[model samples]
Target chain A: MTDLPRPSAPPVSAPTPGGSNLDVLKHQFQQIWQVLAALALIYMVFFVLSEPFRSFDTLLSIFGQAAILAILACGTTVVLISGGLDLSVGSIFAVVGVIVGIVLAEYRLPVPVAVLIGLAAGALMGALNGTIQVLTKVPAFIVTLGGLTAYKGIAEILASGRDLSRFPENFQVLGSGYLVPMGIMFGVALLTGLFLTKTRLGNHAFAIGGNEEVARLSGVNVRKSRIYYYMIGGVLAATAAILEVSKLNFAMPARGQSYELFAIAAVVIGGTSLFGGRGGVGKTLIGMLIMQTIIVGLSYLGVGTSVQRIAIGIIIILAVYWDVWRRPAR
Target chain B: MTQADTATPLLRARGITKHYGAVVALDAVDLDLHAGEVLGVVGDNGAGKSTLIKALTGAISKTAGTVEMDGKDIQITTPTEAKAAGIETVYQDLALVNELSITKNMYLGREIVRDTLFGHLFGTLDFAKMDTEIRALFQKLDIRITDIYREAEAFSGGQRQAVALAKTVMFGKRIAILDEPTAALGVRESKMAMDLVRSLKDHGLSVIMITHNMQHVMNYCDRVMVLRLGRLAAVRDVADVDGDTLVGLITGAAEDKVA
Candidate 1:
């Protein structure tokens, strides 16, 4: 603060919404802290409110799988931040799981190679979505919607109506059996968090979603950035697939079914602006935790999954509404 | 290459033209801008005013034209090139990522990389350097942004524009072209924007402003260029043309004798 650069010229005033104003940028740490505080308060309220109705330990336990949600949310957040959506994430997750299982079980590939293949497959699929959409100027909705169907088909083909299980002991490590998966999940989250907050790529991702035209004008290599975003998203979904396979120890085509929705929900709950130009992977992590806790706790109480689905729907809607309310009018 | 006039016109466009399919959007326009001058461009809708500026800034490519900076003809085929040539454009919408802090937006494309030895997952991001530089730039602009790192979406409209202007200047441009910088602004805000425009001249950069408000042309401009029907009507000294005469030129009531 003391080494502030002196004004070379007289100060130019900021333009106000209603008048010529110098739109003040208040402290960011303060704003983020408030958001984090609100998030904590909401969680406390959610726990306290739900306590009379359920067990808290169950919620914590189910949250372990919320890592899947967190991963998907990470992908979804990238798409959303880039001013688009990726309904294909769920399908991509499914496809990647099936492919990994096939390459490892039938083709007898090395575990490390399988991981690479699965991740690469996911990235390629995502790149396809981005390329076709940007190249054709098609709305991402349509493009990804097509991807949703196409990828699901690929998953079905790979699984061939049989859940591909009986993998190497190492593969078993990812599921509920070992702590490595948990560690990896946290590691992935940390990496993602750093990618979104610390890297130049992450900064560009946020910038593109905030104002794409402005991003392009600023020389952000918009097309390349979009492609990069989707690639990151693809890798996350595939990684989530590996984690899911480890937990379930099954490469069922349907294993990752509906995963994209969960990820989107987590991202929204984490406080990412659906409108783009706002959000971070860290927020998505919070969102995933919230979801995992809800699913686990509610299930332990034997609340039907239908009810959980309804709860998820409500959570998504309310989360978006909250975001809508807090957001400044564009 | 048209040699840059030693007097150093901040920007010069010779025989600039752009055509879209069968239509001619901009046709053979020549513009000269001098350093430390606020050149006002007034034109009716579809008069190619925006097109000309867009061509200069590389927001759009001209079908034909030579752009000169500092006495040499150069190709400005992209926004990056235009910026590198010391030309900047800030659109009316302000074109800022409101989710970004002023400092972040100011250095959106050009980020200072930090040493990675201590840098974490995203790389060695030097938030400290960014924060310090951003705060300094904001202070210099008298921008009252309290935090240099908050998202831009939280700011008001005028504040967004300020961020945009700061972005252009921070990038180090010699010519700044603003499109309808004050269109949606209130009287006070518009006056403040004009003040910034005037300040650009003091900073030794030429300014080209596109505005619908004739009052601004009369008040803030050193010279006014009026356009009609996709062509130049007249380039008049501010001292000579009244608001009425300028409007007449815009509406084609008067013709430019030079053309």
Candidate 2:
């Protein structure tokens, strides 16, 4: 074997001018090709299924359905890049909705005040998660697992097992209106993209995810950065909660149950590795679109809810498996 | 050379000792570094080379030691503090985020942020400036990276070493501690790294390089420090000593002869 001539080597030659630039473009295309293919496939399926699925109203409905999940996924993407998971995001979303409903219905507060309170409560919840993880040095999976159940219980207690409904019409517009939730999602996506690519904190998050010891050696405030990442996740989940409550014109204690599953699924499907250190907000948006399209497409095709759930489950596994497969084998 | 340059050392470590419970890793090691000089540290396995570097760089807490710079005592209790004191270390592992671009890794902690309202509130990184700085630094070091945006994972071993060295050169102000900087490189890369060491000296920076390769010591270092069994065995100028003599000192044969 040692004496054998190599057979896999390419012919030695000078690369053409602009070859490096072409290689860069090809590398980038390779990264997004799968997601792009998935998008095309979903669009084709919808187009073939019904003429109405291609209508503007149906597209808007899809965006509206995806808006909340998109916001949640944006935050989750940041946390995932920092090499952590937040199972509590779904719980936090439910709890934030409950908090907002309490402020608006029980306390009869102004909408902005209630919204602010909800956002703050969500951030505080996230901060608690971050603090506990850092102080205890426990794995985030365990910490957020505890939070997932505990926060749900808290939300149940807070909402008193009633669906809080009858919001003011202006508040209702924030969710059910044609453009508002979509606008919010677009804004969140843009900001998240900028944060990950053009900010120190964002770079630090990826650096920590890449190698925590190396990040520490580089003088990154690892604990503080993790706390901030969780806080961002928390706030975004709250924002999604607000939109969700408004869209339905009601807040239920069980709202957003298993929403973390959807958010994580979107993130993984977006090509972001669950192991961290890769992926971006743009990819996550594509993941969100793919997910919403699948759901809406299923309903339009008259697939039962159970079948839709099964489909989503299979897709999540396939997406993650493909991600792992695409990576260089260690 | 100035009078003060000859009179006072750039950095001095006096009675630096580290103990891990019942195990003594380093025993009262003392060393001095002068401006514009390369100091090589050599020892056998478990000879406390890495331990000494860690203590100096504040990667671990030393049991007892006092490190001085410019005749003033400095405390390096953490990596951040070591950085604040203008001391940088290129560990054998390189401490680079393999997923990040070279510019990002170079400015990982000390990122350049503009002071606009958006930047101040949101902490936006000035990537253009960082890219320019990286390009300038690479030019200065004669390291051609076709794409500055490429991640460290894409770099070859020697190229990675060069990137790490460039990172150190970018932020290191006082002294650099390189732990076997060229130990993992091939012939060309080793020569590149050795040339970097020599360049650091030319730029009036002090360097402490730890390696088992005696050839590097003989060819690049101004003085060589030998450690045997966690103790300082000998220190000699490269002019006064050869590779065989350094190996003997390292293995305790020369120590027996001296005694």
RMSD of 2: 4.1
Distance (Å) between predicted and true CA of B115, model 2?
3.6
A1-330 per-residue lDDT for model 1 (tens digits): 011112332233432231112323234344456446755665565566565424645444555666666776778887898787888988889999989988878888989999999999989998888888879989888998899989999888867856488888877776663356556767887877777777788888888887788788877888887887888888888998888876777787776677777788888887888888777777777787777666655765678889988988998999899889986443
DockQ of 1: 0.35
Worst 10 residues of 2 chain B by lDDT: B1-10
Most accurate candidate by TM-score: 2
Using lDDT as the measure, which candidate wins?
A: 2
Best of the candidates, DockQ: 1
**DockQ of each two-chain model:** 0.35, 0.33
TM-score against native, each model: 0.86, 0.92
Query: Across the candidates, what are chain A's individual TM-scores?
Result: 0.85, 0.90
TM-score of chain A taken by itself, candidate 1: 0.85
